[model samples]
Target: MTTTAPTATAHRSGRRFETARQVADAVLFEGYVLYPYRASAAKNRMRWQFGVLVPPAWAPAQGEHSLQRTEVLMEPRGAATLSLELRFLHAQRRTVQEAHADGTFTDTPALHLPDRVLVPWDEGTEERVELRVAVPELTEKEIVLPFNRPAREDTEPVLDDHGRTVGRLVRRTEEAEGVVRLHAEELEGPYRVLKLTAVVENTSPWTPDGPGTAREEALPRSLVAAHLLLGLTPGSFLSMTDPPEWARSAVAGCANLHTWPVLAGEDGRADVVLSSPIILEDHPAIAPESAGAMYDATEIDEILALRTAALTDEEKREARGTDPRAAAVVDLAETLPPEVLERLHGAVRSLRAGTGAAAAPQEPAPEALFTPDTPWWDPAGSAPAQPTPDRVLVDGTPVGPGSRVTLRPGLRRTDAQDLFLQGRTARVEEVLHDVDGGVHLAVTVEGDPGADIRREQGRFLYFQPDEVTATEEP
Candidate 1:
């Protein structure tokens, strides 16, 4: 069998495989809610997806209804903030990258994916998030991700960012506050050879790939953002009747976690079931408060206020900083949340005894396009079909989208004097076109219920079919 080589970008250097060789079944799972599939919708909008069980017994229609969800119990230390997002998408197995980087290599990058999936916001609502803290212990929990994999080739048991060879995720599990525990880890990356028996347990809260929730208030400024967002119930158990044995000293994410957690327990061991690798990015942060029965709206605002107060010094200097509506994260004392700081205070000192803050500010990931940060309705209208010059004859009839025609956001070429009020969030949804079917500009000063009535959503903000910076939050 003749094998091929991969390009520089794909290789990332470690592998020497061909693109075609790497080609396999890719199962993409995306979650959405009740909102338009526009570009700027939020993540959790109450939408329904197919395949998921939405028994007609549950709904009147033949389609699957909105996914089911539950408010998982969370317990954090002092001044903790929590934001729970419905799992957007989760998958059990996927035809993924081979065990080795390529035929020449023996192991991979030690990457592991979660069995459960969770995608919160959509691509509409100018939704923004922030993590802020002022008190001694400010813990902002983000998202929960769970992953497990069969072992393949191991290394010299190389060390990773979080330390140790096995990549592990440290989270909170105890009912009592101020406890940060290591829930799970990617001691196993992907496998080159599975027992053909490894199984990834998958569960519910599956939303759809359609519309998401609406009307999001981009988090306010002065908020400190914490990234850790996984919750684990302490004392959980992992029982394996006849689990496969470890290949080598397999490790990638955290060195502490194990597929078969315990070997001496009568039943098995304690472990957490997760959909994906829990992430601490892009969740909301509010005023300081203790964990309560429900998320108090008043408390939400109070956090917003504290965040604002904290940003007082920086606000006047930056645009987003000054934007009262924008959100900002404070970078004070400990890089990790305060609780993690205190609890792990002793443990972390040892973890950092040999290292510096290099891990704190890791390389910034490539900015992801097609996210909520992008424009909701970015159009392919830049180089529109140029019409027949002016009042000339197109087979002698008087055609074209119209001369000096204003094609507002939602207002199509329906006729004259009719405004299409379909512009969702920011203003200037459409545009005005010239007689030759060419757009000239769009409506800018609209939408806000303030001193700009005539300047409706998509009325005056016009451009030469190129300036589509409509309704942008940032």
Candidate 2:
């Protein structure tokens, strides 16, 4: 008989998070809420903008609904249990004091204030929540879970540099929980597709006032910014759609890979904060939009441009003393000094010169090494790798610089290495040679969903000759 270890401890190799700091860094992404943590940011005038459920009558009219459904791929080896920890932000509208342009500060004379989303927890309310899952082979089922109000007694108030009270700091709270059990007999084989639905009804007793009242804003009866965390029994894994861009390489490596939507740093390091109770044996599949390459700006060149674009000349100089990160980026941008605008104009001039024409390559270094080893400290006694010529033929098809090819299925150099989607075509931009004289092709796959240092630098994906099939002209 197989004994099951505790869900959290079963995967000793997995990542853990003790705080929701990392979780919030990921959850509060892309329009979840506006800055200043208030409801006033121009981008956040509309609350409950994402991952929210409004009242049935009000939802349909607002192009929304009370329920959300998403599917997950599960691999079950035996009787197992699936658990979920749900979290969300609960806010209340309250009266506030505002300072006018004319230098007068006064109470708005109303119970509710404009552009304010306050955290008001009764500290004793319990919420009843329902979670359900269904598969083609089984009937729809539900589990009821009671969610407690977040504990806020110890919440510290926030202050600015001038000792002014800005607001209070509120951590993400567990609004509800549920667990679903699966039996081996219920499984068709090793894999099953489960459609999971989490449902929550507005049970808060506080009613929102509308226009004409002292608090003249029409608010939802209950507003929440919802999120979910899934825990699977040991030996089972789950996958979801819309993986984060950084996790695409892992997901593409296997034909039968299981994935879950989890946030990860660009360095591919999983969050170690232990924010959730469940430990997944494999890295969770990320949502496509999470930590996008453009938004994160991991490359030095990209970082420099993004950070310096908005700075005033004075601000740029002050950044050197005030912000080390911004200062470093600005410094790097100064070093590039490339004529990008001229390069664009040159391209247009060359286009008229001839079709399918391109600029000449830069000259090689002045001192070419025999074994491709520079005087820059080659390890003692290590054999130098051989170098390849500028071009080569692959699989009876000519695949050199400027050629196109498709990646073969199941070709992986490492677990996290980008796998060109099977049969997807890419351009062979460069042919590189290693010290051992090994030939490697650097190609950029078209529409690849993966993100890596190479993509950040606009570099090519390197693959062995055996991994690609040279394609003829379009």
Winner by TM-score: 2
Clashes of 1: 80
TM-score of each: 0.18, 0.37
Global lDDT of each model?
Answer: 0.24, 0.40
lDDT of 1 by residue, 252-329 (tens): 111221122111211122222121121111211111222211111122322433343354333312312111112122
- lDDT tens string, model 2, 157-264? 434466655544332332222222322223233234333333344333333243233211213333344444444443233333334454344334423111124432
Error of 2 at 283 (Å): 4.9
Clashes of each: 80, 18
Best candidate (score: lDDT): 2
- How high is the lDDT of residue 209 in model 2? 41
Model 1: per-residue Cα lDDT at residue 348: 12
> How well does candidate 2 match the true structure in TM-score terms?
0.37
